[model samples]
Target: MTAIFRTERLTLVFLVLTITAICGLPLLLLFKIGLTAEGSLNIAPLLEALQSRSVLRALWHSLESSALSALFATILGTALALVIGLTNVRAKGLLVFLILLPMMIPPHVTAIAWIQALGPASPVLRWLSIAPELGSDHPLYSREGLVLLLTLQHSPLVFLLVRAALRSFPRELSDAARVSGSGATRMLVKITLPLLSPALMAGFALAFVAALGNFGINALIGIPARYTTLPVLVWRRLASFGPDVLPNVAIISVILALVALVAIVIQTVLQKRMRSALVGLPQAPLDIALGKHRLPVEALLWLFVASVLLLPAASLLATSLVKTYGLDLSLETLTLSNFAEVLWRQSVTLRAFANSTGIATLAALVIAGLSILLGYFLVSRKAGQRLMAGIAGSQAEIAFAVPGLVMSIAFILAFIRPLPIVNISLYGTLWIILIAYVSCFVAVGLKPVVAAFLQMDMSLEDAARVSGAGFGRRIRKIFAPLVAPAAASGGILVFLTAYNEVTVSALLWSTGNETIGTTIFNYEDGGYTTLAAAMSVVVVLATIVIMVAMNALTKKVPAGTIPWRS
Candidate 1:
């Protein structure tokens, strides 16, 4: 009994220390630096930042773009979700996959693709002989352009959340409405929309937060347009001034974090106020008969899919094949030199690929292993165990909720100095980026494992305990096997996200530690647009392949474990 108590106590301590170090400490340091000056309590930095014209302008721009983009995303995503969820849309599976594709693809990659797709040299437009004249200033370099790209980038998130909500909708409401002679349109406005308000609010808040933190669109489009947002402003300050301006940048990051937190809090309150519980079990989504309107609706839906997915993809492929930017695509102008350069000739690109793969893999595996232990405690019967797990989980959720850029700044602030005992500094190394990835993605990796644990039968572990099985033995022989698939799913998600994202690694990446995202971004920013396009094409393909592979595991895992699965 004493041994068992010691084991549990040790586990709790270890989890607390790990969570505090990885998730809590960096954020605490960030706040410390942002809110203090020279080891003393001070608001001067925050006040000075707020009073700067550039900072104020960027803050306003951030709020404006995020709000507009999220509004568009909510309306478009909800309409699409309704069409697919409440109608007899053909190829629903394919449509869902295509809609969700944008979310999986890195935002920078999407920005690059859209830039190429709409540029004066757009291969698709050129082929149709409708291309914009050369030197006709690129249209997507403005505030409107930033919001447009952000909308396209985040609409998929809203779609997925709203779709998931729709799946749980009770059929009784639809039946009740129809039995009262409500027309489809009227029924939708009065009944369906009201019921979906909570989801709509949630989706809107999600999109707002995502757009607010978006560094890719803000940099790629906003920079040229001379319209800056808070994230891009932070990046520019850090890049232009270096760490000499660390205090100022940290203050800016705090502003960004506060904005995100406010949005989340607003969403939470709205959702709570708007939620309407149904008394019946969840049923299949509504299948409203579109009748004669079906053909037109289907055409519109497919056209949207083509516009969002096919156009950019075709443009990206064409640009990659071209020997140089602005070249007309033909056998004469086409070459694979760009791809070859990035994939073979360029040592930097190759190094980045290797570094990202190694770091992301390590982060994923560590998070998965931690999730298993955390999941065990979260599902344990003891109140103390559950409380410890809850605190750890809440901290993780807070870390994940913080913007990636802010998290990057937090990590820089935390680890820029050497450790007290070991006297080793992690700054300017791949180790810092790896730790940041784990911190930023803890919630993501833990979520599915918790779900799996909740669904599991506890009796197996109880039986093993009765038969004299120790904690580790029961976990190893019983719990781990049952939750293995969920762990794998979570690990894959972490890898895909950490592997493709540039935001967290943006300021952290150095010469030899370049990540795939930062490398690609650098290529585009450095006039190597063709190489950027080629690499983005590769990333898109890799992302699709990974998602498909996860789909193959649907039968083994619990229902809803794989997001793309029905």
Candidate 2:
């Protein structure tokens, strides 16, 4: 009890308070608001809100779109994983990297880029002489287009998870299957695919939840399509009408939460049903000889990547270089003014860049510092270790599990007022958004750190403590260096996530506190699609550099410390 926490009392207390404030408090607030009207117990308001026509429509739309998107993403992403993970593909590392690039692009940016590439003014479409005729409505303004964008956005996630599963697949079984005179196709169907059920289910669940909570693509594309998902509907209602709609928004949040919960439960049940039944060290992944098919397979893979990734990216680049959205691309029509406007000309854009960078970096550093301590507790033999770990894990999970926009709304309700002692409001200042980012990304920062701790050797830490070093000194001198690599990787994850964030910031930002995500969205909303595209180009290039730099850094860390590294 106290003896166990004596040396790390302050850190322990900080963890408890942070978790309670960020996750527990918001949830308790949601319950209070959603279940109450006029500060009294009442289910009438909640029931009414639930039964409203618009609310029912949104719930159905959310369910239908997310389920379809996850299904499509899983099928496509699993195919890529099978090809890249099981086949003897050339430059597998590079291929996987390119394939996962779409996942790294922020959803709103993806929406903007796709719009730039496919709109009537598309330079490529016009050059190809297939541009849609002017005065006709945009083709993508429908539910199908939203689902398409969501599928593309989430497929990389499925691919990453499935590939990881395949990498550790037991080769012993494959070798046995092969020695039994079984053909490659037959072995794959009878032995391999069945074992992959768990991984496939897990990937689908992740994508499903991701699509359920997605706000960016839905906001930009969904609104135009006149298709309102929960997140977008909440954001629009809250923004247009202000706090008066808080009760209604809270009710919608509850529905979304229930949908997310059901998806998780189903995934868990399905995964538990059929164990792979091979528990020992996983052999190297079984590589089936492509024989004469290797060249065509590689070409087909590249072509898919090119269509999904390259064309839209080129369209984005061309749009950025042009003077307006949908302008035909040509040497004479190209200009750098759009880039200049966002990067150097507009003072507000410059301010936004500075604001988002500073905020994201600050949040990353704070979360990293906290995660380092939290990781210690997760592995330490302290009293109440299980209890503390359970609370810590749940809090982090809930904060990240809910959609960013929903979390933002919860934070708004939680901290819109001034504090008691300082009497200062966090709502309109930079602190509010920074606080939101920390709350939203705590789980992300913890994942790699927890993974690193799971693989750490406790022997060195014991040895250091036996030599009379204090707990603080042991942590600073011994454990910190060992886990620093993973911590750095996790911190970068947080930084990149917070930097490219739009859903959370879209609501939390004020006039002077505009973030990069808010800035890009504002441009798009104001009919400056080219300006938005230029800004997105900057983000995409920066994200690539950051990811590449992160990949290089992970080379020194343990294998599994960086989730994407493997």
Candidate 3:
């Protein structure tokens, strides 16, 4: 009995520390940096900056773009979900995979692809004369363009969430509605829409949050348009540090936190209403027939899938091979020189690639291990469950709103000044980068692990204990293998997120500490379009390979062992 209690306590402690490191430390650092010797935090300087007409204009511009994009994306995504979930769409498995492809590729990669496809010298643009005059800038580098790009990148998230809601829908209610002689459109607008209200609201909130916090798209397009969102503004401010730096950062952080909090509250209320509506209804399987309209619906679906997934990718591939962008596309003009220059001619690009992969891999491993242990504690241990639950539940909302650039700035302020006392300088070190990556991404890793843990049967662990198996032994023999796939899934996702991460890395990266993302940014800024494209291709290929390998390994594990299914 004493041994079991000790084991539980140990697990709880581990989880507390992990939460502190990932979530608490950054906020604490923010306060430490902004407060005076008397312990009073100041926001006057930051508020003054915010009061500027230009700053207010920029903020309004960002909010308007984000709101519009979210609204449009929610509608499109809801329509897609309805089509896929209600109708008999053939090759759904293939369609689902294609729909998810855009998410796998980074936003910067998508931007580059768009430029290549729509630029003045491209074959399609040449035919359409969409290219600008000699002194005109490209259309892809504007506020409207940014909205289109972000909408394309983030709409799939809405689709996935709403589709899940549709799948789990109670069909009896719909059947009752149909038997009442209601028209299809009326039933959809009244019954279906009301039923899926929570899902729709959640989708809108997620899209808005993503758009608000987005840095890559803004950096790629908005900067050229002279439009700065909060994340971009924070980055610029941090880069131009003075005595007012800490207060300015604190103000931005508070604004971001408030936005995130509002979204979370709205989501919670809607979700609770949805749950109440769903209570007492037996979940029935859903299969809506297309009833002779399948072909046309499928054609439209395929058009959307192709436009969102294949066009950008194909454009990037074509651009990478061409000797000069905007030149006429000819087989004779294709060369391997761009690839060579990125991979061989530039040592920094190659080194950054390796460094990013290695650091991300390590971070993933650490996150996976920590999350599993934490999940077990939360599920099996009783004493600290409430605390753990509170922390874990809020992790997603907090992480979603905490812009990567802001977190990096908080980290620098927290660590840079205090390191000398510890006889160590952490700034610009790989350890600092790793710490930042892990902290920024741990919430993503935790969600899957916690879900997997909840699905696991307590009986298995109980039996092990009854048979005299020790805590560590039971975990090693039963829990570890069962949860390995889920952990691996989380790890792979984290690795990909960290590897391709540009915003956080851009803030924290220093001389002699470049990541592939930063390297790509540098090449683009230096007007090395071919090299940037080449580097992007390499990163994409490597990411695809890693994803494939992780999926294969995950498949060999048991069905309920994976996070998504669980």
Candidate 4:
């Protein structure tokens, strides 16, 4: 009994510290900065700086862009969900994959690809003879362009959420409405739209938070256009030379965090309502026939798929192979020189690849183990369960709202100073970056495991306990085997996200440590488009291979062995 209690206590302590270090420490640093004095550890000046005019303007711009992007994504995403989910669509699986492709490619990569496709010397525009001037005259760098890119990239998230809701929809209600002589448009507007409202709101809230926190797209598009969103402004403040700049930056980050908290609260409320309303509703499978419009509908769907999925990727491939942007494609021009340059000519790219892979892999392993333990504790343990739930829930909400840049800044503020007791320096180390990745992505790892845990029958564990099986033994024998698939799914998600992540990685990067994201950024900045494209291709290929491997491993597991199957 003493041994079991000691083991449980030790596990709890480790988890608590890990959670605090990753999530709480950064926030504490931000608070310290906010309350501290200018040029010293004092708080009054920080409050005064919060009310500055430039800060207010930046906040307003951030809000405007976020709201616009969210609104656009919601409407467009709902339309896409209706088309794919409510209707009988041939090649539904392929269409769904197409929609998810944008997520697989990092946001920075998407921005760069878009710039290549829409630039003056781009092959598509040059071929059409509609190329505009390459500089300020082009509208691609404006707020409108940022909104467009964000909408395109993030709408898929809304689409997936709404589509899932729609898939579980009660088709009988729609059938009854049709029997009552309701017209297509009227039925959609009156019945379908109302039922989907909660989901729509939740999706919009998520999109809004994501847009508010987005740094990559804003940096690529908005910064050039002189549009200073909050994240960009925060970076600028951090990079600028001034004795008082650090505190001001901290103040701004706190404000952004507050806004994110509000957005999360609203999203939580909406999701709860959605779930409640959907309860007890019979989910009949929908198979809406296109009838006479099938051919045209299929054509439009294919066109959308091609435009969104294939065109940009194809453009990237072409640009990577060609000698120059506008050069015509030929056997002579298409060589592997760019790839060679990226891999061999520049040692930084290769080093960054190694750093990124190592850090991401380590972070994924740590976070996966933590998530599984957390899930187990929440499901099985009696003591501290409410605290555990609260902590896990808060982490998820904050992870969604706090942009990578904000978190990085918070980490710098928190850990740069000397903490003699700990006897360690966090800045510039791979450990710091790993911790940042784990903090930002731990929630992602937790969600799938928690879902799997919830579906599991506790009776198995109860039986084990009744048989006098200790906690560790029961977990090793029963829970671990049952939850392996979910853990793999979560770990793979964490690995992929950390692998392609750029926003936080960019902020925390140093000369000693670079990730693939920063490497691509450097190449793009140096006007090495071919090299950047090659690196981008490498990222995409690596992601696909990892996903394939994970899928195969999951396949080998026996059915119902994993809680996901149940």
**Count of steric clashes across candidates, in order:** 0, 1, 1, 5
lDDT value for model 3: 0.74
Worst 10 residues of 3 by lDDT: 557-566
Candidate 2 residue pairs that clash? 121-326
Better-scoring candidate (lDDT), 2 or 3: 2
Tens digits of lDDT, candidate 1, 297-370: 99999899899999999999999999988888998998999899999999999999899999999999999989
Instruction: Give lDDT tens digits, candidate 3, residues 1-566.
Output: 79976886676666676667666777676755454335676656556757977667767776877888888889888898788767778987667666756666777777777876666655545545665554567787777888898888778878888887876777777788778987668878987888888888889988887787777787778888888777777777776774257566666755655565677688888778775356445464346677788888899999988877666666667677878766555688788899998888778877897789899999999889877777776676465565675575465337545667667777677667546567787777777888888788887777677777788898998899899887788778988787877788888889988998887787778777899888887777677777787888888888777655665655544442322221
**TM-score, predicted candidate 4 vs. hidden true structure:** 0.91
The whole-model lDDT of each prediction reads 0.91, 0.85, 0.74, 0.77
Q: Write the per-residue lDDT of candidate 4 for residues 212-294, one digit (tens) a residue.
A: 88877887777778888888888777666532577677788877887887887887887677654544575754667888897
Q: Model 1: how far is 51 from its true place, Å?
A: 0.7
Give the Å shift of residue 400 in candidate 1: 1.2
Model 4: weakest 10-residue lDDT segment is 557-566
After superposing candidate 3, which stretches have Cα over 4 Å from the reference?
A: 31-37, 127-134, 240-247, 273-275, 279-285, 381-383, 392-397, 418-421, 549-566
Pairs of residues clashing in candidate 1: none
Query: Following a full C-alpha superposition, what root-mean-square deviation does model 2 have from the true structure?
Result: 1.8
Candidate number with greatest TM-score: 1
